[model samples]
Target: MSKKDKNSSNSRRDFMKTSATALAGFYIVPRHVLGGPGFIAPSDKLRVASVGVGGMGGGDVRGIYGTGKVDMIALCDVDDSRAKQSVEAHPKAKYYKDFRVMLENEENNIDAVSVSTPDHMHAVIAMMAMKMGKHVYVQKPMAHDIYEARMLTEAASKYKVVTQMGNQGSSGDGVRKMVEWYDAGLIGEATKVYSWTNRPVWPQGIPWPEKGQTPPKDLDWDLWLGTAPYKDYVENLVPFNWRGWWDYGTGALGDMACHIMEPPFRVLGLGYPKSAECSVGSVYVGEFQQGYFPESCPPSSHITLRFDRPGKEDLEFHWMDGGIQPTRPEELEANEQMGDGGNGVIIEGTKGKMMCSTYGINPQLLPTSKTKDINVPETLYRVPKGDQGHYANWVEACIGGYGSKEFDLLSSPFSVAGPLTESVLMGNLAIRSYDYRAPRKENQNQFDYPGRGIKLLWDGENMKITNFEPANQFVKRQYQGDYSL
Candidate 1:
């Protein structure tokens, strides 16, 4: 190895050794003792811990274990009931409800962490883990806001940690195929993209519950509200309904766009949107009146974002949710499924168009026959097991340690997921702005949505809305109490 390479390697080893000694009080197991007949050394096995092991979090923990190359060292979650399965499954693993406690105590033993919490807590949990020299695999949207995403993306490089976002489609072959096809000129110069989802399947567009139900006996309501402003426990907000609330969720666009729109984002080499505009659905309070719920996301929204491509022509991207869909392209066959029935994306260009369902699965060209006719070379490499390999890929990357080829090969590393998330949240900014209201001075009972009517201009670098001041508020949010980025 070159002298520089040797010095870097020694530096990393020295840091790990120094950190291990500093925390020996909490981590007493010897590396060699963890090795024995028919077993790899525990030091060699990537030691992984997880936060929020329920629902998708539960699935993430299992996926990482399924790789068989990692040691499950610890698990954390605010709700005891939700963490039951993971705790029962890993009998030897340490358990805790507070992530900060787990991290402080287990820092010497863990090589990486899986953050599968709600949207608002993602950045804080993952950022703290990354800062402590642990590789991180964080679930989608990356963060609750654009500014947080940008910060985590920059943090990934600064910390020199291996990182991956839980946008599994990023590891799928379909997206790679789309990228290669675009590079091959199969679709000419792309100019537009549309993505839609049938989501917010939970309650939205309603007022926050005025009264509190008794909090679940096994759940810590305040801890679950991490990073978001505190609120009295409401019925059905735990488990999954939180997606409808602005404080805890990023709405339907944040929940599904990462999976459905990733292929288009990857293929186009897109960046921040130059401007955004949106129209939202309204709930009826009476035959002639409409209800407004500022704390809840709209039931439906159609957002358009324009991008200034560096060398190519400007592009327009449309995002729809709450079962809204774009008009069918004339080139598609009448019988073909429109993006797996409930979720899908379509990219249009001068010569042709391409479409795919969530996770970038089932990709096909317009006319359907084009998929069979096209012979574009496979220039981009595919993950070993397509989307299923995403977990193992991150595990292996962590085992490869940081700065190795394996680390750099992660498909959805923060370097990429960060910007993708920021782009997706731009739509939410428009959706929220569509509902922004100030008291109408002439009428005390009514309000005017000053945030509407104009295209909200954006300055990506500065992370602000150049045209509308109120819309910029969604760019970054205030963290409550001890939680922060």
Candidate 2:
């Protein structure tokens, strides 16, 4: 209503329209820099809009706002019930049920975007924001598919925007310390790595519900489905259980590997796996019948990924989920715990071994006694507040603008996260391919599962499976309806 307020609103609208038409390839400058002459200053807050604001997303909202240097300009979510807390927390922010509407209306008003939606929707939302020249902070497992991860990585570079993945562990001190010890030759050359988790605290390895229920009044089921195939609403599918499904979620591997496997990936400087193989647990529906559900992720799985190390022998990495764990090390005491009892990682080398829990916490040498005595120098810079600082790190970097000192020091920039995500998704790729079946040539009634009992050779540069032609379908999923990268 005030004269200054109206003028300020008009200026923002004008700038957004002009930028959309004329600044297609230009980097978005800091908001303070947009003010002419006497109005220029560096104290302006970084304005942010968030797409998902419940569960893990709510945590992201609070973390970024806690930085005291950001303005929560807008919020969007498909389910109002899930987003209640976030909407109430930031009453000043405009709220919308559709992200596309939120972005179109607020594009000029916000400086950055925080994408905390489900796995499948992450890529499309993040890509649209990057194309609009807004900095982005996407949650872990950067994308649902390897191709999406690669595209997001390339978009970050092309758009020249500051970017960070939501794997808080990437900014933690545990990983940095492990990096230092590995670099100091304390562990010699890491030859084998194992990471495990107790996940699927939700349902998996099951058939789609034979029945569908009416969606809740507050939930827009269609928008929530987004890129996933259209399906009738089912109970217990929203909020959290979706992680077990193949369409909307990436199962346990995508849900937790970004946090659990990050330490080894960072310590060893890993890239795409040269080959992948996997075996999955099965459920029985009757005395003689095994449950075959392609729509859902398997109940439990053990994935082996082979990574080539230039001149040295290939590194063997193993990932286990559904409460599975690796063999106990001889160096560890009989009574000692491995990986905090539930989730953990073990990096074995020629000389010694080291271990850590999820989020790279509580890193220790195999002997445990040697943990305190080792003398590896702390060479890597520790992010302030460690993992808890993840959100603030991105906020400060956005305020500092792309290519600034703050941006350069980001912990999980897409350049690092993209490769990490691709490696993580490879485990899922192998798992899905394990169930690929074909009809027998002689006996039409009998099926020959060709994808089973085989190692899929990978050509990382081309993002394709060199040996198994059918397995390549999982590389980049087909989008449903109008949703796309």
Top-lDDT structure, candidate number:
2
In model 1, state the lDDT of residue 470: 79
Q: After superposing candidate 1, which stretches have Cα over 4 Å from the reference?
A: 1-43, 286-289, 434-447
Q: Write the per-residue lDDT of candidate 2 for residues 362-438, one digit (tens) a residue.
A: 99998999999988756666678999988877887787667655665678888778888998999888877734344
Tell me how many clashing residue pairs each candidate has: 0, 0
Off by over 4 Å in 2: 1-41, 287-289, 434-449
Q: What TM-score, computed on C-alpha atoms, does each candidate reach? A: 0.89, 0.90
Residue pairs clashing in model 2 are none
lDDT of 1 at 426: 88
